[model samples]
Target chain A: MLTYANPNRFMQLARRLTRPVWGLSLACLIIGLYMAFSAPADYQQGMTVRIMFIHVPAAWMSLFVYTFLTVSSIFGLVFRHPLGHVAAKSAALIGAGFTLITLITGALWGKPMWGTWWVWDARLTSVLVLFFIYLGYLFIWKAIEDPLQAGRVSSVLAIVGFVNVPIVKFSVDWWNTLHQPASVSRFDAPALHSDYLWPLLVMALGFQLLFFALWLLRMQTEIFKQKLRVRRLGLVETSNGTAS
Target chain B: MEHVFYIGLSYGVTGVILCLLTANTLSAFFSFRKQIDDEFKPEDSANSP
Candidate 1:
């Protein structure tokens, strides 16, 4: 872990991992989709059960990514890990994208089953709040000019905002929500049948891979931006010295 | 099937958004890489010492 604190080493690891991660993601997605379509529809939900392949994995990623962001923020804030802020900031947009997918697909799935486009159910509302927190985190990055200050502010916000994660996860169980409770993840045997469970896991893995691939690319970009900033500053200082 | 529209739209929207995000990230990456390389080219380094 400390090895990655060195930006050059981190860059090398990112370069090496990006292509393979992407390839594996594509492979998993292809297999996952095939299995999803082939799986039998729920007797109750019918054909609409197919939507779970994409939707459930996306919802998982939404929470997973934010948790990852929070961990990275902790590293940055507490340990002053150099790449920590870069990792957290790079992850924000990708996490937001997943959150958006979760909301949109959740609504799409909800409409046919619930007889409505949306509701203020505990599960639904908490997830929406999670999305807003993601947006707020990104806004902090954009609103502040100084990278160090932006990182500190956003990291603090991320750590504070993570309180919503547990609420979102437990909302279905804690309240009489229209949304269903955990199917794939639970203390007992998963609620999903093997048919749905297998492909859902595969798709979830694919989504996770996709997140890492994108996260690496975004982090490398941020590192390059930092390099450019430093080089420009050095050039300015050199010119000033010559002028003097 | 009536459910087809809902399912199709969901997948379609997901695909579009992921594609756009990928494109945006890739472009930003290349643009930043180019800028950094430009700032530290051979000529600039030769004059450093």
Candidate 2:
């Protein structure tokens, strides 16, 4: 783990892993989409059941990515790992994208099934708050000029905002809501039929792999940006020294 | 078949968003790499001379 803390070593690893990760993600998404479309429609929801293939996976990823950001923020704070900050920063946009997809798809699914486009239900409200928290975390990084300070403030906010995750997860059970409770995560067994379950799981995996591939690319970009800043600063110093 | 619109729209929107995000990240990466390479080439030439 410490060995990877070195940015150069990490970049080398990232470059080597990039092609394989991308290939795997592409393969998974193709298989997942094929399975998703092939699955028969639900007896109750009819064709709308198809929305679950995308909606459920997006919802899962929204939370998963936030949790990932929180963990990376913690590493940045505790270990002072630069890579951690880069990772957390890169993940925020992707996580926000997932959250947006979740909310929009949920609305689409809800309009057809629940006879409404939006609801102020506990589960829905909490997820919206989670989305705002992602925005706020990203805002802190943008507003602060100093990288260290920005990272520290953002890390603190991320840690604090993590309380909302569980609230979003358990809101359906803890309170009355239009949203359905956990179907696939329960210890007993997934409530879904195998036909639906398999595709959902595959899509979830594909989304996760896609997230990782994007995250790595973003992190690599950030590392290069940092290097560029340093080189430019060196050039400035060299000119200043020569002038003096 | 009526519900097909909602399902199609949902997947379409998600697909668009993911594609945009992927494009933005990759473009930023390539641009930064180019900037860093350009910065280094000048320095290397100056140092050799």
Candidate 3:
């Protein structure tokens, strides 16, 4: 995993894979969207049920990306892998974007389906906390001028905030909800019908692939920016030394 | 289900956002690379001296 940190090697691999990724994303999304639309609406939930296809996948992605970001941050801090910080920062920001979409789409869905734009339920509250964690991670990156120190500080926040992830997952399980409980879990079989289940899965897969492609591209950009930052700082220090 | 509106909104929003993110990432990558390359040029090579 750490071996991918070599920027030249990473770029070599990234350039080779970039075209295929875009092609795959295009195919997956086209097919997935068709299936998502084709699925019959719930008799009880009615047309608003259509929003579940989008909302559920977005909710799943928000959690998955945040977990990926946090684990990478730990790997960067504990193992001192150079690429860890880049992966973590890029993923955090992207994850935050996904989380925002989740909340927005959820609210939209909730407005029609649940009769409210917001709720104080455990599941909603925990997800709200997850959003804040993402914000805190972004603030750390923006506030610190020194990238290394910023990385160091945010890694701590990321690792600590991970405790909330499980809390989010369990909130729906532990508490009763007007919102439906988990459909799929590793321990228990999914509750959704095969008709509705398949499209949701495909859309989820498409979203994950898109997430990876975006994360890789952004990580590459951040790495280049770091190189530029070091070069600029070195120039400033040397100019001062010569003048003095 | 409202056939046109929901599907239109979902796909419309997704497409526009993806396009924006892709363009934004590419611009940042190429521009940052150019900045770093210029900083390391021989004429302004502070570390070389």
Candidate 4:
């Protein structure tokens, strides 16, 4: 990770990796959707449960991206790696996108499954709060002009925001909620059989790779902009020096 | 048919978003590389005393 901190080195690797990353992502998506659409209806939920094909993966990505952001922020604060902050910020934006997808798709699934468009249940509420945390982190970045100060402040928020993740995980167990308990999560036996499980896994992996590709893209953009800003500032300083 | 529609919709949205993102990334990559070259281009010649 630190090895790629230098902007040039990061760019080198990102450029080389983008094509293969995209290829694999698309391939998985094609095969995953094939399986998802071909799989039989649930004996219980019928057609509505198909939304899980998208909802589950989006939910996974939302939480996963936030976790990545928090870890990256911690590294930035401890090691003083500038790229760490860039990675964290880039990841925050992508995480928010995934969070939005999770909420929206969950709502779509819920309307038919739970007979409600929205719920204040534990699992849903925890996810809502998690979404807010993502926004709060992004807002902090924009609200402050000083990146270093923003990094410190948002790093704290990132660390604190992590508590919601476990709540999101355990909410079903802790409360009588309309949201279903963990089907794919429990270590005992997956409630889902092979007909459903494989497609879900494929979709999950596709979403994860998509997140990485986007994260790298965002980080590379931020690094390049920083370089551009530095060059412009240097020009201004040199002009001022010559004028004096 | 409804299930097929929903499945296609999901894949469609994902594809569109990824395509746009890829385009955005390529443009940025080319422009940045050009900037790096431009910043260093002037010193490459050998004619000046």
Q: Top model by TM-score, which number?
A: 1
What tens-digit string does per-residue lDDT give for candidate 4 at A170-210?
Answer: 89999997888879977999988989999999999988887
Best by lDDT: 1
Model 2 iRMS: 0.7
What value does the lDDT take at residue A214 in candidate 3? 81
Candidate 3 chain A: 10-residue stretch with minimal lDDT: A1-10
CA lDDT of every candidate: 0.92, 0.91, 0.79, 0.81
Ranking by TM-score: 1, 2, 4, 3
lDDT of 2 by residue, B3-46 (tens): 87898899999999999999999999999899888878887999
Q: Write down the lDDT that model 3 would get.
A: 0.79
**lDDT tens readout by residue for model 1, A1-244:** 5533599888988899999999999999899989998999899999999889999999999999999999999999999999888999999999999999999998999999999989999988998999999999999999999999999999999999999999998898889978888877788998889999999999999999999989999999999988778878888999999999
How do the residues A1-244 of candidate 3 rate in per-residue lDDT, one tens digit apiece? 4443487687778777766776787778778888877888788876666677767887898899888988889888999888888889988866777777777777766776667888989888889899999999999999998888999999999999999899888888799976677886556678888878888888788888888788777877887787676667888999999999
DockQ computed for model 3 against the true two-chain complex using alpha carbons: 0.35
Residue A169 of model 2: what lDDT?
90
- Which stretches in model 4 have alpha-carbon errors above 4 Å? A1-5, B1-49
TM-score of 2: 0.95
Per-residue lDDT value at A23 in model 2: 86
TM-score of each: 0.96, 0.95, 0.86, 0.87
TM-score-best of 2 and 3 = 2
> What is candidate 3's TM-score for chain A?
0.92
Determine which window of 10 residues in candidate 1 chain A has minimal summed lDDT. Answer: A1-10
TM-score of chain A of 4: 0.94
Model 2, native contacts kept: 0.92
